[model samples]
Target: MDVSFLGGPHPQRGVGVVAPFDFALDRELWRWVPAEVSLHLTRTPFVPVEVSLDLARLVSEHETLGDAVRALNAVAPEVVAYACTSGSFVGGVAGEKAMREAMTRAGALPSLTTSGALLDALTELGARRIALVTPYTVSVTQSLEEYLAEAGITVTDRAFMGLTRHIWKVPYRDVADMARRAARGHADALFIS
Candidate 1:
């Protein structure tokens, strides 16, 4: 008698990521994911409309998210996560809930958004006061601040780059400096949004 063994990926051990068209930190996420798990990422359509409420509104549309989620659902991920912070918060708290629910329905699994994840992290850490740092313009940064405020987080200090384009082009050194400056004020933690 002869016997053979077949090996393949384990069930319910992979993660699905839905990113915005302009996202550039996929490598970072990949580097951090545990080797035992697989990462499946999909990008939603984006027009690169400067980082602002307008940009947020455009990217957070349910129609676009539905298409993106449908595409990711083909892989049958155990959990789906939306990786765009602005897109997740642009619609406010209710909008974030709706987006997560839509992804859950389309991907047929539990879903998470960047804003939701951030809030969870903050809550877990008991950090209600935050210093915000971002490469977005004042208007865009303000919108994010408002979203956090709705969640009961206070923005004690902030630093903005006021750049409307090429946020990914920013250097890491500059980002570090911005974060330091933003955290100068008394706060529980610094949030680089």
Candidate 2:
């Protein structure tokens, strides 16, 4: 990307990823996606703002997320991704759309959330049966499974990585292997945390 476009870049192309804490994308996504835009990281700290799987619960609590969204919009990111997949889907398409609408209405900016992107990606990939691997407890992870199922795709199998899912410099290949092991089943593809 042109350096001038992204907040007067230092080295990498500047893309602002405005999200709540714990909203990290898998390396696999970047492997296939466009690389012209790089991300500038900013977020609500985890200690202050907990990640909520329930979309309504999330929205109800964090009314400031709208202001956060507007602040990110002011940064003029090439793509402003909301970055919470399960929470958005827990609200369903309408919920995701409503979140985007609130952001745009507050700032007149276009945005995409992980939940919308997942469904879109699934549609693009033509996946029917899928394996779900999340970094949530069983109850929340099952909510995600149900969320996906409500979208018409079946969750053939599932595994949770507990509430705190992290990698202390573990290699991507190792993570992939763990994901594969965790979600071993006769299914289409797997969603790894």
CA lDDT scores, all candidates in order: 0.85, 0.62
**Model 2 per-residue lDDT tens digits across residues 1-193:** 4467657744544454545555555454456555565655556445433344543245422354566666766566655666555656666667777776765665555667777778888888988888876656666677677768778989887765555444224466765765777667777777764
lDDT of 1 by residue, 72-131 (tens): 777777888888888898888899999999888776789999999999999999999999
- lDDT at 142 for candidate 2? 71
Candidate 1 lowest-lDDT run of ten: 1-10
Off by over 4 Å in 2: 1-14, 22-35, 45-56, 59-62, 165-174
Identify the candidate with maximal lDDT.
Answer: 1
Candidate 1: which stretches are off by over 4 Å? 1-12
Give the C-alpha miss distance for residue 73 in model 1, angstroms: 1.5
- Give the deviation of candidate 1 from the true structure as CA RMSD: 3.7
